[model samples]
Target chain A: EPEVTQTPSHQVTQMGQEVILRCVPISNHLYFYWYRQILGQKVEFLVSFYNNEISEKSEIFDDQFSVERPDGSNFTLKIRSTKLEDSAMYFCASNAEGDRYEQYFGPGTRLTVT
Target chain B: GESVGLHLPTLSVQEGDNSIINCAYSNSASDYFIWYKQESGKGPQFIIDIRSNMDKRQGQRVTVLLNKTVKHLSLQIAATQPGDSAVYFCAEIGAGGYNKLIFGAGTRLAVHP
Candidate 1:
């Protein structure tokens, strides 16, 4: 079965540095999303992207965060300046246009900021 | 604020037994619900989902029951095996233009052999 895949399974960066988490969602899926989970916390929605634009975003998705679909298959999340609290497991998900309710998640990129 | 929450934080059951995990949602506008299983170091795997128009749905060895009046959802696994051990989360998609998932605090399921 086709599944969502993410790059740099584990990422470590300095507190003030930048990091980009990349994901390649299921090829035919139209909607893409990014979510994060702090250790021992529930997953929180970050943003949703469709048609090369952001559909919705949470308060945590402030100016420091941005998402891009630079290519047909690549969806990326970039953090301009990482904070200690920014360390968490970032997951990328996608669903087909016909089934918007069932989003499939990638293995996730573990972001560690020191 | 609307939120999804689990009834239990952890549940331990013997192998070959049945397991039922429960969830409650405060959002009446949520039209869809899903259950996901996450093993350690992996992402959430889709188990099954039910739409608000229906009260019950079944897939493989699992069944999902939704109570729209109480806003309750439950996932039942029959003849649970050791591999069934994982953290389960109930998620919802509210009625909106953007269908972003809202997850509940997960419930850890442990199966003892």
Candidate 2:
């Protein structure tokens, strides 16, 4: 089965530093999304991207966060200025279409903001 | 309008026993529901899913039951094993937009030998 893959399984960065988490979704998948889970907390939605534009985003997705699909297979999430509160596991997911099939999740990138 | 909730925070089960994790969703418009398992340091893994049109859907060892009237959902794992220990989350996707997934807080399942 094709899986979503994320780079930098673990990332360590100081406060106010810039960090970029990358993901390569399934080749044939069309919809992509980014989510974050604080330690011992519920997983929260960040943003959803399709057709090279963001369809929607949650309140947690603020000016500091941005997503880009630089290439056919590469999707990246950039945090312009990291905060300690941003420390969590960032996951990338993808699905074939709208709400029909389940979205497959990546192994995740653990962003550690210190 | 999108809030998926779990009835229990944690569940302890023994090997060979069946484990059932329950979820309740308030959005009656939610047409698709999914069950995901997340390890200690990993992301949510897709276990099974059910659409609103269907009342029940079954996978290899997992089953998803959806009750639209009450807006409740449940996942049943047969013959639970030690490796099955993890945090399970129930997510729902609404009909109109693709960003409709509302995830539950999650339930931690500990399967002991």
Candidate 3:
């Protein structure tokens, strides 16, 4: 089965540095999403992207965060100034339809900022 | 505001036994629910999902039951095995655009031999 794949399974960056997490969603998927799971916390939605524009975002996705479909196959999340609190498991998901459909998740990129 | 929560934080069961993980949602407008399993060091994997219009849905050895009135959802796994041990999360998509999912705290299921 085709699955969403993310690069840099684990990332370590210095505080105040920029980090870009990359994902290649299923080729045919139209809706892409970003979520983060703090250690021992529930998964939190960050943003959703469709048609090269952000559909929705949460408070957690503030000024420091941005998403881009840099290419036909790559969906990426960029954090301008990484904070200690930003360290978490960042996941990328995609679906063929927007709602009521199963969104497939990638293995996730563990971001560690020190 | 929307919140999804699990009834239990952890559950331990003997191998070959049945396991049921329960969840409750505060958003009455949520029209879709899903259960996901995440093993350590891996991402959440889709288990099964149910639409608001359906009371029950089944797949493989797992079954999903949704109660719209009480805003409850449950996943039942029959003859659980050691491999079934994982953290289970219940997620909901509220009615509206984008269909962003809100996830519950999750319940850890431990299957013992």
Instruction: Provide backbone clash counts, one per model.
Output: 0, 0, 0
- lDDT (0 to 1) per candidate: 0.95, 0.90, 0.94
Clashing pairs for predicted structure model 2, backbone only: none
Deviation in Å, model 1, residue A85 alpha carbon = 0.5
For each candidate, report what fraction of the true interface contacts it reproduces: 0.87, 0.67, 0.85
Better of 1 and 3 by lDDT: 1
* TM-scores of all candidate predictions against the true structure: 0.98, 0.95, 0.97
Runs in model 3 lying further than 4 Å from the true structure: A98-100
Ranking by DockQ: 1, 3, 2
**Residue by residue across A35-102, what tens digits does model 3's lDDT show?**
99999999999998988999999999999999999889999999999999999999999999643368
Tell me the deviation in Å of residue A81 in model 3.
Answer: 0.3
lDDT of 1 by residue, B1-113 (tens): 77999999999999999999999999998888999999999999899999999999999999999999999999999999999999999999854578888999999999999
Q: What does candidate 3's lDDT look like per residue over B1-113, in tens digits?
A: 79999999999999999999999999988888899999999899989999899999999999999988998999999999999999999999855578688999999999999
Docking quality level of the chain pair in candidate 3 = high
lDDT of 3: 0.94
**Candidates' chain A TM-scores:** 0.99, 0.96, 0.97
